[model samples]
Target chain A: MKKIIMEKEAGRFCENKDIAKKLREEIIEPTIREKEPVIIDFGNVSGATQSFIHALVSNVIREYRDQAFDNLLYKNACLEIQKIISIVYNYMQLD
Target chain B: MDEKWVNVNPAQLALTAALALKVGKENAIIQSQNIPLSARYLDRMGLYNFFSTPSPFRQYRKKEPAGRFVPISIIKNGDDQSKFVTDIIPLYHLSEKNSRILSYIVGELVRNVLEHSFSEDGAVVAAQYYKESNRISFAICDTGIGLWKSLQIWHPKTDKEALSLALTPGVTGTTLELGGTSENGGAGLFFIKSIVKISRSYFVIMSGDSEYTLLKTRPDIKNRLYSDPFKDHYAFSNSISRFNGTLVAVDLKLDSTPEFQKLLDDIGDIYDSAVKESRRKPARKPKFI
Candidate 1:
């Protein structure tokens, strides 16, 4: 399993898409390709933008479909962050 | 320009700041003489800082901005954006719940500038809290490619058309795909507009020679979110003096704000349906034998 701590890279508010892109390219995509589970920890992240959340995970969801949902996990997300995550997930999964 | 009285909102102030930056400090000049007493608010808002010309008003003690306003600031990159978001909440004395809404707006708008606008001068931003109205008004302006230019890939014929597409849910300059590219969902402006709409506030966007303003929702009107921007009560003009960049301003009533999570849930649902509906295939015409 691969663990990525969001606060360490994105500070308290995770709104930087550059960092999101980097994490997706460097960590999330690689781990998912290896067929290993990945956990993205949002501990200490007070808030996040829908764009930030979208940039971070939308590609994985697009490429991997069900495996991405089953293998990827979000940890310590506040209600706001969870809503944003769900928004991205729903729209991206829509046919 | 000199007037007997001066009144301006955060959006106007941010635009002035951006213009000053664009004109360069040496070329930029503010008429300092015979300035109205009401113009002191301009000085307080830090407008003079961007100009090489001296401030017309006499120097006063610098006051702390907490619980009142955030003076004009320039956000050039991600680091600057993050720091601004962190520092702005205390400046407004906003509670955690309130801060989330403001942060979300700032984050999405400024990031739009950094990633899409391509303005080396970056985004000029300012905010003010009104005690009487119990609301906050903020604006972001960039001296980069305007909406028409940004949406050229999608073939927006005019600035007005570009503004319309920009506010449409899930339509982004990055890609024509239904869900948008991985990096952009094209939902930032739509989300911001919905928040302001539900709060019964005003939202405005200007680019090139066109501008679109979402008029304040009347109390008697039922609050409804629309995927099409023009369906809402609004004022639009295509004859405004051409501006080479983009400006977005919003007035959000703090008192009227619904719970942040609930607001998102409602907006999310509307956004999903809009995307799904857009992707729906058209019904086939009856076949002629």
Candidate 2:
């Protein structure tokens, strides 16, 4: 199991979907393929928009299915980021 | 007062009044032939302690701040826009979540001004926070080619039609041949509309000869994420006068509980549905409000 601090990989502000897609491919994919529990830390990330989180989470969920939740962990999310994650997660659950 | 000031356009009137108040000369007798759009907006926006005299065009101003209108200089680039967010957040004591929302909105709107407006002078933005009323108002104006003319190069549309289409997602005037990037998803107005609707904010957009005003009617929590297309929540009308550029005004409740999670959920759902509708095997057109 390994932890990925988003602010360390990206910057304090993560708003672009293209950057989110890149992060998922570069960091999250390898971790998932190795079957390691990946804890994604959002500490020090000032803010994130719906586009970025949607791209990062949806792409992984599309590939890994419902099991993505089991292999992944989210941490250090402020109220703002937490809200964004909740929205993305709910939409992913929808039909 | 010069007679020319009497017949000034809405933008000029608004700017003149703002400058007057800024310079601490709120009381000034104005003589005009008719009540301009600017005066009407000033009355509606609750700016300055002023009243029209017995004559329709003549008004007397009193030096008092009727509204907490914050004066913002022209925002030409990202740095200026960021300064606006920083200034506004502290002025309103906005929650961190609300600050983020404002940043996203202002950032996107200003970016459009820089990228699409082709305005030699750039854009102007202003804000007002009504603490007692628990509301905040923001306005952005750009003296560029209006939406109708800008979009006409791609599709021939009336002023009203151009304004309507501008609010739709993935409806960009920039074509692939024009070197627009894939990220040019044309979602700026879409996101703005959605956010304003969800937050129950009053939104008014005027460009050229057309204007659209939307009064928020939904509750903070609603059964649907988007507004009813046929509802009277919005109105599209032709104005008596034309603006050479675009002006957007928004009035939002400051007391809003930041239900950002739900808002984000709605945005995600809308985007997903839009994508699916476009790529469906059977071929289907996406529905937009």
Give the best candidate by DockQ.
Answer: 1
Interface root-mean-square deviation, each candidate: 1.0, 6.7
| Candidate 1 global lDDT | 0.89
Measured with C-alpha atoms, the lDDT of residue A11 in candidate 2 is: 57
DockQ of each: 0.80, 0.14
Query: Which candidate number maximizes lDDT?
Result: 1
The DockQ for candidate 1, computed on C-alphas, is 0.80
Residue pairs with colliding backbones in model 2 are: none
lDDT of 1 by residue, B2-29 (tens): 5678879999999999999999988887
TM-scores for all candidates: the values are 0.95, 0.62
What TM-score, to 2 decimals, does candidate 1 have?
0.95
Residue B40 lDDT in model 2? Answer: 41
**iRMSD value for model 2:** 6.7
Least accurate stretch of 10 residues (summed lDDT) in model 1 chain B?
B272-281
Return the number of clashes found in candidate 2. 0
Model 1 iRMSD vs. native = 1.0
